[model samples]
Target: MEPRPLSFYLLAAFFVLFVLFLYGPTLTIGILSFQGPEGGLTFPMRGVSLHWFRDLFQEQAVGDIWGAFRRSLVLGLMVMVTTVVVSVMAGLAFRKRFAGSAVLFYLAITSLVIPSILVSLGVGLIFDQLGLPVHWAGAGFGAQLTWTLPFGLLIMFAVFNRFDKSFEEAARDQGATAWQTIRHVVLPIIAPSLIGVALFGFTLSYDEFARTLLTSGSHNTLPLEIFGMTTNVTTPVIYALGTLTTLFSLLIIGVFLAGVAIMGRMRARAGSDAGKGV
Candidate 1:
């Protein structure tokens, strides 16, 4: 058995503390969200109750929390599917050297470097010039894609780098077409990473505020709604909303992880059965 170095233990402890630093505030908010109706934002729980959670549903001056939440969900789902499809296709394309591929790669990098507010304004202006109304699903979606696609592309680059080409060659030798080879073989192997890309896309799009600010002309997404809430309300309902959304995000991550685990188990069982048969 190999023993890990002392540096490994030090790094592990550092990572643990880093995670606590990130999630400690979130846990505090989740707990305080249950504070009594008269509770203020921070500490010293007035009393523990579901008052704030219930308050999220009741009408208030917080600018239609339910509507904004639904819009965010719709936008997040739309972005997740689009990002997976586009990122996977782009990733596959990048595997081959095409004319101007490097230029395209650099262009994606440029989108990342540019300030998001400028992209939002540019998109808004373009939509205005075209006499088109910017909907959450329209210009806003495109703006988010500009942010998400580059990330998805970079992740896929790393995934593909470690992938072996022999599997595809073997599939071809068995008379499989290109599409069949990809669908039956390549996709299964990379499905987990693609799920990760989907998660990134949805999370980025859902929390995106700057790029969404100008483009989402009519309706506000969750982040914009939360910002609106901060000005209009002086209640713990906002923390309640944050806790709910964080739980939703965690649920989505759990589902994806379960899918990955199930796929792995299925593959392992098949392999073991084949081994026993041999």
Candidate 2:
């Protein structure tokens, strides 16, 4: 075999450093989370134990972590469903030219360039003016949509842009209605992409801090609660919380990826059966 180029070694070293830069902090936090009862936040482990993890379950002197987690989970699910549905609909609508389509599309994505804290503040002020309560499920939800929807719309737009019109033509040739075409043909083909959009929506909303800061009202979401904890709490328990949340985020990503894989396999099997029948 030919000797590898020097440039290849350089790129490989760069990639390794990039990976460490990305995950080194998380790895450190996970390790420190296991520090014994007497352990400090920095290195030089006193010993190893689950004491900090247990402390997480005990009464907290600061904010309500579990309550915040529950709120975040519920909000994430809400955002995921809304993002998928709205994104798919917007993608379909934009596929056909309508009056002011360009203007509307630009308006939809304008939020992407806006500062998140400004969005949060704006939404809060709107709620106050309208005699509505600013709340995590209310104003907070609306603000987060401004952030997640643009991403979801962008993903769906790309998916549909490359989508084969032949499938829809074939479905119509078989007497499928417009809704039927979308439900049976378009949706199934785009199922995996929707899962990806859902993943983005959930994860982004789960970890969002700025846009949720002012609009979440009195009830803190997990990110906000963690921020609050950082100010007052000085213990390995913080690391334990960080480790658990990181693991939960990974679990969510894993579940979404598994869903995508399952759908891919099902689609493949269906294609094979169709080929056999043909």
Candidate 3:
């Protein structure tokens, strides 16, 4: 083959630099997880051990970290469910012509473009003025849901846009009611998109730190718990947690890929059988 052009070399270099920028910190933390507590910044190579991983469990605030992690997990789950239901309804409503639909859609888009800090602060102040229940007060997960819902609606809109209306029409022709058609046809057709949306909402809710700091008040999610530790002292324990989180994220991605692969194979097999019959 002929030698690549100068532009090709420049493009390759840019791609490598981009990957390093994105993953360098994560890689460093993962490596640091293997360093012992007394190892400090420099690694002795042979002196490296799994002591940090073990000590991570024995950390003074392990219980608190676990509690925060549980809270964050529950909050993520609730946000995902709430987002999916609300977005689905909003998606359907926006699919048809209606009064003020454009205005409502614009407002939803504006929410996404607006900074989370302002949204959090505004909601926090309103809650304070209204004397809302203590549980719903500033920095709480409930308030965070407001921000998640708008993005969720946007995702649902994109998913619904590609949905084939023919499926609903076919069901209706067979004497099914509107609700039945939606329950039986539309849901199955959009199942993958719905899963993807839920994952997006969960990730958004879990990683939200700035808004959580403003709205969480006395409650601590995992992000807040992790960030709180930074003020006093930094330790390899944080690196250990980072490693675990990275692994968890990889696991989720793996499961999603497996699901997509299975679906693709099923579709391919169905098409192959159909062609054989023809």
Candidate 4:
């Protein structure tokens, strides 16, 4: 075993502090989410109670919490499924050096760098000019895709870059059609990365605010509903909403991570047989 170095200890300390800094306030809010009905936002507990949690269901307590939550989940799931398919196809396309590939790559990059609010506003204006209605699942879906697709493409780029070409070649030699090669060979190997992209897609779409602002129009997603609560309501319910959203995000990410880990262990157990060319 190697002796510990001072730099190593310093880095370890920094990482621990960083984790604390990142999650400290969120944990506090989760605790305060249980603040008694009589309690205000900050500080000492009036009494520990699930009053706000129960109130979360009451129609008058918060405007359309369930409706907004359902919309966000639907949108997130939509983004996840479409993003995996599109990104995986795009990743396969980018595997070859073709004309204007650089141009397309740069375009995706540009979409990511542009301010999301601008995209939302531009999309809203375009709909206005076209005399089309702006709807959460319509224009808002397109807008969130602009944000998520770039990220998905970037992730796929990394995944495919490291992927071995021999798998596809072997599948082809086995008389597999292009679709078969992708489905049976490329997909299985890249499934973990795709799960990772799905996580990114769902989380980004669910939490999105700026890109969804104008385009969501008549409907509100959970995040937007919370924004309304910020001004229109004052109570521990806000903390409860925050706690709920944070937990939901954590649950989603955890499931994807577990999927990845389980897939990895399966690959490991399969050993040389799994990696061998068919």
Candidate lDDT values, in order: 0.90, 0.92, 0.76, 0.92
How many clashes does the backbone of model 2 have? 0
Q: Per-residue error at 39 for model 4, in Å? A: 1.4
Which residue runs does candidate 4 get wrong by more than 4 Å?
A: 269-278
Better of 1 and 4 by lDDT: 4
Q: Lowest-lDDT window of 10 residues in candidate 1?
A: 269-278
> Can you list the residue pairs that collide in candidate 4?
none
TM-score of 4: 0.94
Worst 10 residues of 4 by lDDT: 269-278
Error of 2 at 57 (Å): 0.7
Better of 3 and 4 by lDDT: 4
- TM-score, candidate 3, is 0.86
Ranking by lDDT: 4, 2, 1, 3
RMSD of 1: 2.3
For each candidate in turn, give its C-alpha RMSD to the true structure in angstroms.
Answer: 2.3, 1.6, 3.0, 2.2
lDDT of 3 by residue, 81-197 (tens): 888888888888988989999999888878777887887787678777887743423346666776787887878888887888887888999999999988988876776777777
Question: Pick by TM-score: which candidate is best?
Answer: 2
Is candidate 3 or 4 superior in TM-score?
A: 4
Model 1 misplaced regions, further than 4 Å? 1-16, 271-277
Clash counts for all predictions: 0, 0, 4, 0
